[model samples]
Target: MAGNAGVSKPRTAAPAASWFGALEPDHAGDSGDDGGNDAAHSRYDRGEWRASDVADSRFLSRQARRIAESGQSGLYRLYRAFVAARAALGITLLATEIAFAWLITSHPQHGAALVLCAVYALATLALWLLPNLLGPSRPTVAARLRRRQWAATIGVDLLAFGGLQLLGGLLNYTALLVLPALMAGVLTPRLQALGVAAASTLIVLLATQWNAGVAGATPLLLAQAGLAGAGLFVITLLAGELSGRLAREERTARGSLAMARRQAQLNRLVLEELQEGVLVVDRRGRVRAANPAARGLIGEPQDSSGESFALAGVAAWEPLARAVDRAFAEGGWPEEGRDVLLPRDQGPRQLRVRVRFTQRREARVAEDYCVLFVEDVRTVQARVRQEKLAAMGRVSAGIAHEIRNPLAAIMQANALMAEDASSAEQQQLTRMVGENAERLKRIVDDMMEVAPGLVPTPAPLDATAQVAAVCSEWARTVQLPPGAASPLTVELPAQAVGVLFDGEHLRRVLVNLLDNALRHGSRSAGAVRVWLGVADDLHARLGVASDGPPIAPEVERYLFEPFFSTRSRGTGLGLYICRELCERYGASIEYGSRGVPERHRNEFSVAMRRALLPDSESRPHLGP
Candidate 1:
């Protein structure tokens, strides 16, 4: 009965460990406790051995569950089939015994016929009841042993039939050969072939011995022997081939299940660790899956009433939920999240919702379940906003201190000039005071936050092309020191795929970088490389390099600080404002020098997320 089950899938160590408590799962091996007789730590347990554990280990638990559930029926069916075949064999034997009794009475061979009937009846009865003892709950080893035992006994029937044929041979019995062939059609092909081969060899030898003095072996007998051997051999080959195919199929399905389970486990782990509240709902709006996150924002417990239903403490939640439902129906998310004003204990608290959906891929047989993924975006946004504000506060205070002293000097000098106490040189000195004062104020003003609400524009803009335009502008007005030259270089990819960004803002960003290259990095007879490229499909990157005096490490560390400078005439807000503006557009800037030895050189790079553009029709309908 068990052998009929064929190949089986491997089991995971985790669930077993949870149930037994003794199995310590690890990367290299499964180390179980041998401390006591407790089932969890039993040393004698056969289940502890991990012979082919890796063959079926899935990171996902859910996928394994699905496979296990579906496989149960197939396994049960195999056992049932074994039991049925045995019952049918028993009935055939009983009828054969009755017919033999009638034949023995007429032929006067009662003793031999009676012995054959007894052996056949006992074997058939054993096959019939064999499956009952080897039920599903039996341990794997026990079940496998039972299957081998019964399967072997079925082969023993061939020996009995061969003996019966030998009895007939002593009496020139040709009728006894029919029993062996009938056995071939009923038993597992492996067993049938072995049985038939044994019977044919013995029976043919006996026939040869009995007919040795004849002209030749009877033609009809030779033909029958050939047909029997060929039939049994072909059956065995086909059965062996089919069994191999079935085993391969079993392994593949098990592998897919293992992978699915492992993935599910990882997803579950990430879901539990997530900081934001998350909840999943099906297409009918029924809650399907939920992580450690709360049902509602700010730790609200979820309530379910069986059917698809929803509730929110805030009225705004309805519209947001509706949007999520629409996105799920649409099959992909266009927008991930949006902030909502939800009522809190104190007052209205800001919260954001991000939702996505995926249908159960394997459950196509029952495609009603939809996996809705939900996350609270409020926490992420709040953290980002707080960091940006703290940065601005520090910059504002520093700029205030830097600009105050210069402002007082300019005001006092202007008052003296108002009294007409001025020679030509005195007037020039006052003019110098006014000029330096304007520069200081400009620096402080530029140090302020990048224009209040500039974000990546929703329209597509080409970063590479933006850098090219800035390169042209730099070429026209750039100046350099002796031995240095303005390098005109822009590496624009052949394909100009645009991203969602404000053209004017990106252009300004490029202009600042280009000017910095000309001012601090431009080199003559030295390599000056500039590249505007995309990195890893996620970020747009721009790097400008030059072989000039390398920037000192100490200065590079604080180069982006507002009002920081190494140049005597610089406003000090150039690099600082450039960085602040880039951040406003979801960009970052990094500065570094080339080599540490002789030649002084630098690289200034900027990066930003590759933005996604809306449809062309929604973007002012720009014509081709």
Candidate 2:
């Protein structure tokens, strides 16, 4: 044990660290005169140093304490109910005493009987009210103390009844004696219950003899009293034993319930964090629970009212609903998932829906349910594609390293052949050979671009300004006539939109998009528009849209594929290169034929990662 600052290390061995130990400081300490300067300095020098002291008891979190208190609250509620029941029994006793006293008022000891009854009634009322009136708002009284209080109260009432019988010259109050004794047996310890039984029997025996007007005790009367005491004791002991067993059972049930609740919460947390969507549905096809991923896959909000919607209700989910019906028809889970198409603004998305049925047994009945695991096909395909591309890139890079030397020699030989040709036809053949070699070289360059490990170094830049600049530079470099360039329009947001992008990579993506748009665009003003804007608040949008004729669905599908070109002269690697560069910077390039309103234009949009702007700047106005 050592002292540093005001912290004192415990003399005992440090306790084992638990999962939650990180919440507390390692060292035990009191606040010091250094005003935390020493602690701060120590923390600075030894960054992981814990400067404050914590005891083993501090391991329990606030949530754990709350859960513990909740379990105890249930026990407390049961105890209160028992107390109330006892109070109610006391009230019943008071009523019986009043009626008995009225019925026997003409007796010689009427005055004493009436007084005793009055005392008993008042005592019962107090027993009923005291528990409610006493102690703090949320009292934590011990179980032993509460039981003792009840026993003492009930004992006094029993003695009062005994005295009334003795004074009134009536027979033993055997029926009245049982009430307090039974309650004592149920609520108090075995010894206390036995004591109550013995005391009650003695009171009744004395009262019976006094009522008999006997000078001396008879042997028959003594035997009768002994028999009565034995019966009372047996009742008390058996009743108390039963009550103890019932209490133990109740505690066990409560513990099981608490454990169930904790497990359910943990299961829900795990479900919510899963990448696949999980939907719990009843046999009727109503969604019982849809996790966040499921909601996202279904194009619904996390807090959506999808649970209320039948599986067949939403038009977008019709395909999935049909798939579910087929699975349910088989009366079990399908071995393989069914693929379904969903509509999105970007394009049609593919999803795989899987079903699993669960039967829950409750008492004599069984309830059946099913869980649907919905996974996006795009995500799965993307992961598979990325793996394949990585493998291909490694092999291609090795192959390209070997092929370049021979390719270089071939091009040199073609050039030499062209120089030595004597006739125009010979020169033409050599020229064609040289041209094909150059095309092969270009294809190799494009393949190199597609190879993996091209990491983009992103920097915060104004997307609107960068895009406008790129478009202007493109038009100037193309050297188009003023009339031809007039068709190219730059539509920038009123304010600058911040985005994270590599300047060179973004320039390349924009150049390729603009080049394609200009070639196929309508020969009219504002026919080709480059829009820089924001999308979903999390991404900056840079779209190259053209008022060009709609492309065929089949053509649009492979537009971004490398070496897939429509024109004879087109290389077809332009869009593919653009996609590779955009992906390197964590951006996406998507093609659309009918996305923009009032203009059925072909668009290639690049969604760049949005950057947080400083407080000094305000967000740009999103145009209507």
Candidate 3:
């Protein structure tokens, strides 16, 4: 952990050198002054350096961060932009120079200086500007000018500087201002199409300088600058070529990495999409990787590195890790790896995940591992339950049928015995056997109700009239015992709720519904209501409604399910059969437990498609 601590011997990572007056920032809170240079403290400002540090994050805009991250964009675009900016500045100066030569005569004293200065600025501007313009943009204008125009344009600029130096002796020393123009070309240790600029600057400086000694030495000075610029240009060109080669190599590497990543993704997808959930963990009991289904079956991934798997509650992964560790420690699995029960917030999921030595014989690295797969056992459990129920149903149905014939025969014998009863004991026995046999007959009939496709017969009728008739008949047969007056009420829609209907089926369904209301809702009040109507003539709907006790939420859930009943006196097929028969008649029924939110009144309604009244010619066919 030593960082430039002056410990005499360095650690693994330490600064080898410093540049740009910069010293290494201290680590572990020591500055290492030793009084060698007090100014070293100022050179390295930890806080300021940290402010612009890549980890600071705030300094970079989204775009800047993206460019830094993405290897997709080449640096060529950045270089093109740099060239364009320099070119624009240089061109503006060039135009100014040509104009100034014509304007400076009025101020005759400043005339030579103005022309020289303007010309130099113009030349500098050209060197910086034109290359950017020519290289990436407008390579072929009219005919093609290519990069040759760039080199030629720079040469023309240098010659203009030279021509200006000759035009006015000593006065054109103003052109020295253009020397800084060389900085742009040699700015970052590279000069392309800029050798002429340095040569031109030297030519002007010597030619136009007033001092004879300096003027005489001009050619040699110019020769040195030209040589420097030429050498620098060669270096720049070589560096650019190297950068291009490196970029091409990097791009190829990136493409190969991308293909490998896709193949890995496809392999992972195969594991994830399987019905069996899979979790792979290392020796540390941490989830190394899992699939989409597994994440959903277990929990969402909270660990970005997938190494904190115990927190993820992936139970199967822990055992797999142990199994793999054991397999590597020994040789093979112990008892085919134990069954792992991975629990989740959803439910306790049981997985019969097993482990074996991972087949990696070809891999050069250590590869002994285990694979754990979790299969859902809920469906298997459900199927076993259904098989048990079916077996019971078959056994019960057979026993009930066998007892049915004997029960009928006993009832007939009891009737004959009642006629020959001699004393009270014999008479009582006859009545008891007959009553018990009748009860046994009822149980047998319920068993017979389980027969297949025993649908209630449907016959077309005037539904409105049929409803009225059924209500009258129910009132006659099942009335309040003696003197209690709870009137059975019947309401009907004024319009005919015509439907392609079943008369007998409607009677039987309404009878069952009325019985339910009385048995459930009217038990306390001893009153019931029946209503028949057309909810919608457009869809040909006929609706029947009854009043009863509100069906509680628990009861409402399975109210219509076959063999699901709340009544103590009868089988649960009443509501279920009613709905099935209605559907067969091209109708549907909706049952609700409350009139409104505040009131709890059990209500059942049967609705059917209306039978269309036939046309004039067709009407005669029904007349017979």
Candidate 4:
């Protein structure tokens, strides 16, 4: 409701032509269907077909139902007011008859008139005191009974006034009939109101003729009674029209209120879920509303206890308070947003603050409030850095494509030269050329894999065999002896473990991890360990651990980030490429310490989903 002050009023209905536009039939479809078109036109002329009878019947019915439902409260209040008015009128009528009976002793039916007046007063009082007595307990039944109750009330008023007028001679009781006529017009339909007016007019004429025949009155008295009846008809018509207009306005106001509430709820939901901070602050630095992100940015607790706080209350928020004050002082927001630094015990937090004012027409300066949009500078910088890295990767991928052909030619030439070399020095030179060319080729392949379209097709592979073969080859190449005395230790489960991964991609990942371990390990027995086992029924785990110093916290943060490494000679793409390949196969790789407390070692581990076996095999079998 607070934010809904600016909601516009509901629109009024369109002109008559526009309202009935949908009732027109399609001429295109009617060209070959003259008989049906004529029947439809006849129905329309006879007033049997309306806009509601057209294709929008459901829409009209729903709108009518909503209007009836929304009007129930106002209807109940009006009914109560009418009941109270009837009771007062009944009391007044009874008092007037009592006074007349006391003053007129020759009147024969004065006593009977007093008795009728007393009974009518009691009946109206009972209905006023217990309005629900006329209706049943169920809502639908009560609604139907309540409608009839209005007619019954009007009828009783007419009968009581008519009886009193006939019994009392020359008392002029016709004025009381106006009350019933007005009540019928306001509470009942137009046809019902007109019927009540006609019935009242008939009763007046009958009473006047009876009195004239009994007392020999003049014809001029009959003319006065007719004029009185005409006045009642005019009053009923005017009251009915005003009441109908009032009901329409009430329904429109209710619909506007409901729409405003829904819009406010939607705005609150959007603000709560927004990533950027939003705060509404007044001129005195009081925070009217603060979203979750804003509380987090300002280091305020997120629990909403409904207690109010000011920005000036927090020492670190002084800069923000000053910005709000400046916006209010200048009577406008800054063209460029300013940055504010909050000094915390941990470090200074940089925030970009943009302000906008909520101003009303002819509003005082104190009534205006400012909305602040806050964002973290570090997050903005990180997003920009990621975009730059993405552009650099695209350029590097193109360069890798260009180097691929020449690098392959160089490797082929070096192999041919090695075969022709007779001298040891010449052979050594050719071997170096071949090794360097192969290294360059591996770099190019890794770069090319960074392209977005590359998708690896994974297949079921024996984890135990892959780890065993990779570890054996690596140990042999490093010239480490195979036994308990070897620096490299390889462990595998007795049962084969299967995983979903591309064979060559898995081989490349394992080779990279082993190379890093060997380069960093102390080269002692059991210094480098490789193990393959089942993590769970759904996954297989592979880990490589080495006796190396714990990586620094800052370096560990960027362990898998591209182009980041502590070693000056390191390309930094090795670990990055390994992570990319693992993720492609729905696997994850992470670095942590995994050994025992006495001999803690830095470890890199991979978790890959266990491969699904065929129906014939109950479990994974070793692959050939």
Q: How many residue pairs clash in each candidate?
A: 10, 3, 8, 0
Worst 10-residue lDDT window, candidate 1: 15-24
Model 1 agreement with the true structure over 326-426: per-residue lDDT tens digits? 65665655365656555556676665655554543344443444444444454676678668866876767577667778687777778678468458887
Task: Flag clash pairs in model 1.
Answer: 58-262, 59-261, 59-262, 60-261, 60-262, 60-263, 60-265, 61-261, 548-600, 550-600
Stretch of 10 with least lDDT, candidate 4: 1-10
Q: In candidate 4, what are the lDDT values of residues 189-267, reduced to their tens digit?
A: 5666777899888878888887777676567978988998999899989977776666556545445444444566677
Cα error, candidate 1, residue 504 (Å): 46
What would the TM-scores of all predictions be? Answer: 0.44, 0.54, 0.38, 0.75
What's the lDDT for candidate 4? 0.70
> Can you write out model 3's per-residue Cα lDDT over 133-158, one digit (the tens) per residue?
33333111110111233333334445
Lowest summed lDDT across 10 adjacent residues in model 2 is found at 15-24
- Superior candidate under TM-score, 1 versus 3: 1
Model 1 per-residue lDDT at 506: 67
| RMSD each, Å | 21.6, 13.6, 19.8, 10.4
Compare the candidates by TM-score and give the number of the best one. 4
lDDT of each: 0.52, 0.64, 0.50, 0.70
The ten-residue window of minimal lDDT in model 3 covers 1-10
Ranking by lDDT: 4, 2, 1, 3
